[model samples]
Target: MVMAHNPKIQEALDARDALASAITRAGVQLPAMDVRTPWAADADEDEEREGDARYALVHLGVCSASVAVLLADVIVRGLTS
Candidate 1:
């Protein structure tokens, strides 16, 4: 089979891997644990900057988890059919 090299997909995969490493270090799952970003804040430029940084990194975990859930649902439906 031929494989396509997509930069965004590769980046997302790399990010997921990094998050996995961080989660392993933190000793918590992305779903069950409240993973706080280092730059989280309530408001203002500083807060926005921090929140943006955190969200950027953490969003990968969220997207990966979402995809996993979707795939699991598809598998369940396929099995039940």
Candidate 2:
């Protein structure tokens, strides 16, 4: 399950792609990302707000970290058993 919906996920994904392309090219540096979330239509609009993007990104990062931790924990437990 995705814990947070970093509004900039799309941009991040795009930048990752661009970086891959740049690696193939000789030389070219780009600028930082500039993304925006659209006006939402739900009470959870709080999640879609511009300011909340950071929070979402943090939450997402935490969620990912948690998953890694959980997996490592399980592996350790299994090894010990």
lDDT (CA) per prediction: 0.45, 0.44
Candidate 2 regions with alpha-carbon error over 4 angstroms: 1-6, 27-81
**What would the per-residue lDDT of candidate 2 be over residues 19-41, giving only the tens digit for each residue?**
53643352332233233333356
Residue 58 displacement in candidate 1 (angstroms): 7.6
Stretches off by above 4 angstroms in model 1 are 1-4, 31-81
| lDDT at position 78, candidate 1 | 60
Counting clashing residue pairs in each candidate, in order, gives 1, 0
Q: What is the alpha-carbon lDDT of model 2 when measured against the actual structure?
A: 0.44
Question: How many Å off is the CA of 61 in candidate 2?
Answer: 15
Angstrom error of the Cα, residue 69, model 1: value is: 21
lDDT of 1: 0.45
